[model samples]
Target chain A: MELLVASAIGVIMAAGVYLLLRARTLPVVLGLTLVTYAVNLFLFVTGRLTVDQAPVLNQGHESFADPLPQALVLTAIVISFGMTAVIVVMALKSYVESDSDHVDLDPQDDGEADS
Target chain B: MNHWIILPLLLPALVAPLIALAVRHDIVLQRIFSVSSTVILLVLGAILMGSTASDPVQSYHLGNWIAPFGIVLVLDRLSAMLLVLTAGLGLAVLLYAINGWDAEGRHFHPLFQFQLMGINGAFLTGDLFNLFVFFEVLLIASYGLMVHAGGAARMKAGVQYVTINLVGSGLFLIGVGLIYSVTGTLNMAHLATEVGRVDAADRALLEIGGLLLLLVFAVKAALVPVQFWLPGTYANAPPPVAALFAIMTKVGAYAIIRVYTLIFGDDAGASANLAGPWLLPAALVTMVIGMAGVLAARRLGEAVAFAVIGSMGTLLAAVSVFTQEAMAAALYYLLHSTIAGGALFLIVDLVNQRRTGYTDWLRAAPPFVHTGFIAALFLLGAMAMTGMPPLSGFIGKLLVLDGVRESSYAVWIWGLILGTSLLAIVGFARAGTTVFWKSAAVGGYLEPARPLAPALPFVAVGILLGASIVLTAFAGPVTVYLDTVAEQIYNPSGYIETVLPTSGHPEGVRP
Candidate 1:
């Protein structure tokens, strides 16, 4: 279970990074979404993987998954969702203003010299 | 549990919603609420600072829940001081914004208030996860403000800024998760107690987690290798928003000081001074690169932005030592740099507003009305930024240099800080001369597109510069206060006990 979760997280994060490096804003937004997903999963498993266990303490339950990470994941999900919405709107706005989808302000002058 | 500790967060949170909902369409009403709330915040902050002066660390657990189980807001001399600074800066920037900058966009007042709430929350939160939440709050508010008066350039820069910060947010969560997994606690006070007892096997994970967190703070602080986003964002952001952002980077610095000194300081058995080794070198490099950028900038606003980065480098170098004297000096430098950087941004805006054709560009232009007064303000701002005598910047640098003199890296610290000051002086001089002095040879006065008073902006600039002068004049008492602040920072027993008065371990949960 740990291997499955950890590998899934690694693969998702790698894909996120790849998408993040793309020159278009949509891909970057998608990349951020993917990264957030991976983070949520990573946070979910931080309490150690447990199946068929209550997240909170119960008299009948001898084992329980840590509930704090679950709460943390919930908050992370909400924030990431809101942020994704914000970025999408911003990207669309930038596209309309510059009339270009490429992330750089001037695609022709894309170099490290000026920045 | 002094209720005042929570007011800094509550007042802005409540006022922001009121402005957004009740007065969304009324700029006048929005400004009135925003400005009044900020004034109250400043007063509240001063009260908190005074309270902490007598009683250092005070923690307020939400819902009266015990520590480690519930979210907590820890108020200390550090948080109180930052709260006051944020409110003061917010008020000045709010005034300058209402002077006409707010009209450029809708919802400026709400967003400004929300930004203040986030900053104050970040300063006051005692839990790592809560800090992340506040960071998001601020970043979200800043995004709205960043592109508030949107142009093509500003919007594009805004997109880039949002992307980088999203990536940073991901890293932040990963760091917090790693730390939580090992320590089984996210409360900073609880983590401080737990960090030392981690198994030998888990120490590496904890260290990696700590360093990852450092990277996140470094990104926010605009430390080297992660500072690429600052110049573009600051230059493109509306001057008033950029001025408020002067406190944002300091948020990162504040977090570094808080987390490192309290959680990973000398008491942590295996991870003692976890950030010390990496911080100094990166800080020195940050100084060099920032000054070089200042020298190379083609626009006045961009130059000031780079100067901010340089100042952060200087401030962090002092903090890297972790000694009370050095931390005191770092706090003073932090206060000085925020005011100076904020003033310079405002001054650049004034210059931009006046120039006929080239707004804030470094080339000579036709003279404008009030050139002498605006130029004089710019000169004083530049002097403070470049650490010239008779201003707070000079005193800040001297304190930093003297504080770090006993360290092994003294030679490097001395050499880099001194060299960078020279670089900054030259850079500011060249920009000032081209903008103010060389413009005298140009043909005509820059006629106004509209009749302008610019009284509020000048007043705003004057208030900030006056604060800098006050910092210089009262350096003695200020340093004495900062000495206690630093002393409280290094000795976290007071903080830890206040946050978690019972068992060192959190009793309610298990991992």
Candidate 2:
């Protein structure tokens, strides 16, 4: 179970990072989404993997899955959702306004390598 | 009483969208809303500061939910101090902005109101999720305001600024997720406790989390490597917009102090905030870079922006040293930089207007604007920025260096003391020589009739400058309060008790 979840997170992270590194803005946004998924799962795993325990308290369950990480992950999901909306708007704005999603041909940043 | 914390948060969220009604009107309604909301915020912050100043902890459960279940707003000396800064600066800027930046009343009011809301939100939020929300509000409002006049220059800079901050926002989300996974509670005080139970091997994840948080703060604070985006963005922003922006960098400084002292202060053996190695070196570099940029910048606004970055670097460097006095020094310096820097920008805009929009420092400024009195204030303001005495900036620098001296890190202390003072002198001289030393040779910029000249902008400028001088007189008492604030931050046991009374041991997962 741990192996399966860990591998899943790794794959998700790999995919997101690849997209983030893309030249255009849309792919970078997508990359961020995938990264969010991995990060969420990775955070969930830190509470240590629990097979059957829901964070909710029931009559006879011996140990509860840690409620703290559960609560935090839920909050993370909400904030991430807001973040995704922001990035989408940012990309769309960049696309409409500049007609390109590439990072500004920054005068200061890329000069050393290009020269 | 905990609900009073909500006032700062609630006022902007409620008032922000409604600001559009002032669009067609003159600056009157805009002034009322911006000034009133910010002044109320300042008063509320003062009360919160007083309430928490001597106490160890105070908590307000949102909607009456207990900690570990519902979201909470925690107040300690550190949070209270930051709240005062965020609110006080918000009011001052709003005040200056009313007449100074309100030349075109159309869109400035709404955007200014929204940005203040965002800043206040960042200061007040105890939950990590809300921090991101406030950042979005601030950044989005900034984007609109940056290009409010819709010029190509402003728009171009806005694109880069928005894009980079989005990247920063993304990193922040990932960080929160990682931290939540490890600690379980979103309440900062609770997370501090939960974070300690994890074994040393798992600490790297926390370090990454710490780094990401630091990354966001560093980007905003405009520290060394991530700092390049700040100058272009700030320089092109409209005048009043630039004055408001003067306080924005300090928000990042505030967060760095809060997070370091609260979240990562203790996690000693293995699981530190990853702040140690990078911060000191980076801070030194940031200051040096600031000095270098100031020297190199041809445009007046750009020089001011670069100088602002260097002052922030000095503050951050003090923070990285992580001693009580060092923190106080950083705190004092943060306030000094915000006031002096903000005043300088307002003056820049004023002088630029007089020059009829030539912001190049080396270009001859309009002669009608620089009477001996005005020139004298400009020189004195420059001196204050450089830490010369009988002025506010000097005293603040003394406290910080004194803190450094006590730490006994002789070389770095000497480096910060001598290096910062020397670079400050160089940067100020470079910009001032171009700006004030020579009288304007113009048939170029027209002379205005003596009595018919602009009165209001200079009045606003005088108020801002006078406020800074007053701070110098009260410096002794203020430094003591700041020292106490520093102690609360470094040892946040008092902080923990205020938030979660049952949680005995102090744990530092985050601030």
Candidate 3:
């Protein structure tokens, strides 16, 4: 179980890094989403592997899954989605305003350079 | 009355859609929503503070499920104070928003009101997961607010800000997942107690998870290397919007304080596998660099951005030390800095209100009437930032430095307190001279350099200052309350029990 989760996380992170280097704003947002998936899973894995163990149940079994990480991840997923939406919208607005879809290195300084 | 606790969360959420849909057309309706919501928040904040001040461990278990299962809202004096500040600032910003709002029924007020829901919720939430929800709510509103005027510069900056923060959110999720995988609990109080039960050998996993969480906060807080997006985005944002964000940074600082104290709890030895020692030095360094950013910046708005960063540095530095005095000082100073810094930023926004001839510092210089008073206020706030005395700033500095001084690491305390203070003064005092005093060749006067007879906010600040001054005299008692806060946070069995069923108290405060 650990092997599967770890390998899956590695693959997700790799994909995230690849997309992250892309020049376009949309891809960067995509990259961020993918990376978050990897991260959420990775955090989950920290509690170690627990199969056939429900986090919600009776005692003396000496092994319930770590429920804390699961709870935290649920919140993370929802919040991350909200952030992704906000960024995507902002990027779209940027594209519309500046007529550019690619991320620019040097941000315009309110055009204060000339003044 | 018990259910009244959720009003802070509910009123904002309920009113937001109403404001967005029904009140979009009439400015009058917008004012009513904005004003009413702000007032409601203020009253709610005061009630929460008073109720929780002595008890200091108040919890509203949403659905009453108790810890290890249910979601909860916790209110304590520390969080109570911050809630008021957020509401107070929200009120002031909403008023400012009314005149500056571009069009009718644009849903701006609704978004602002919704944003408040997130902030106050974040402060009050007892569950770790809920913090993320609040953050997203606030972040979404901020994105709209950032690009409200639809300017190319802000839009560009907003895109970067969004990207950077999204990455941060991703990291945060990963951290949360890891912590759950290890701990099996999400309620902060429950986690605090259960966390201490883990084996020492397995501590590395928790440390890594803690670092990931810290990384997320570091980005949100805009600490050192992660702070590149702040100056660019903030500099371009409408002054009012940027001013609103002045308090936003404190959210990050507040999180660091909340999570750190809850999970790690005051230097628990090296074997405890805590996230403190590293954070302490790093926080100090963040401050030094933030001050440097202000010193290097050319423009006034950019300078303020770095100074904002500097304030974050101080707040986090106080948190990293994990001392009662330090924590209280961090809390007090953070509120003071946010309100004062936010007001100053608003004043700058007013400075750019586009009179026919007048402009920003770069475009032209304006006349000075009450400019001296404004300059003095900035100086006072800045002086407090430096830990200079008599004012609340001095009091805060004394508290923080005293905390570190009491600890064994004397050199670390001195280096951080003295060095950071010196750099902060350099950053603020220089900006004070240039922005307010050096009235240069420009077109004409813009908005109030200082209001003719002191506007509502100015008077409001005078009251805030007076309260803070009173705080200095009451520092000893407040310190005792803060000590209780630190104690309650560091050891949360009581909190966990309150959230849990009465049977849960059978273990009887085990940590």
Indicate which candidate wins on DockQ. Answer: 3
- lDDT per residue for candidate 2 within B79-182, as digits (tens), equals 67766766665665665566545554356767777887788777766677667777878877787777666554556576567657766876776677667655
Error of 2 at B435 (Å): 2.7
Worst 10 residues of 3 chain B by lDDT: B355-364
Model 3 over residues B302-396: C-alpha lDDT tens digits? 76787788778777777777766666667766766776566656655544443223334433255454566666666665555556777666777
Q: What is the TM-score of chain A alone in each candidate?
A: 0.87, 0.82, 0.84
Runs with alpha carbons beyond 4 Å of true place in candidate 3: A40-82, A105-115, B102-105, B266-273, B354-390, B440-484, B490-493, B505-511
Each model's total of backbone clashes = 0, 5, 16
By TM-score rank, best first, the candidates go: 1, 3, 2
After superposing candidate 1 on the true structure, give the runs of residues whose Cα lies further than 4 Å from its correct spot: A59-62, A107-115, B503-508
Model 3: per-residue Cα lDDT over A3-108, one tens digit each: 8878989999999978987889988888988998887777666656778886654567656665655655676667677677777777887898888887764543
DockQ of candidate 1? 0.49
**Which one wins by DockQ: 1 or 3?**
3
Docking tier of model 2: it is: incorrect
Whole-structure CA lDDT of model 1: 0.92
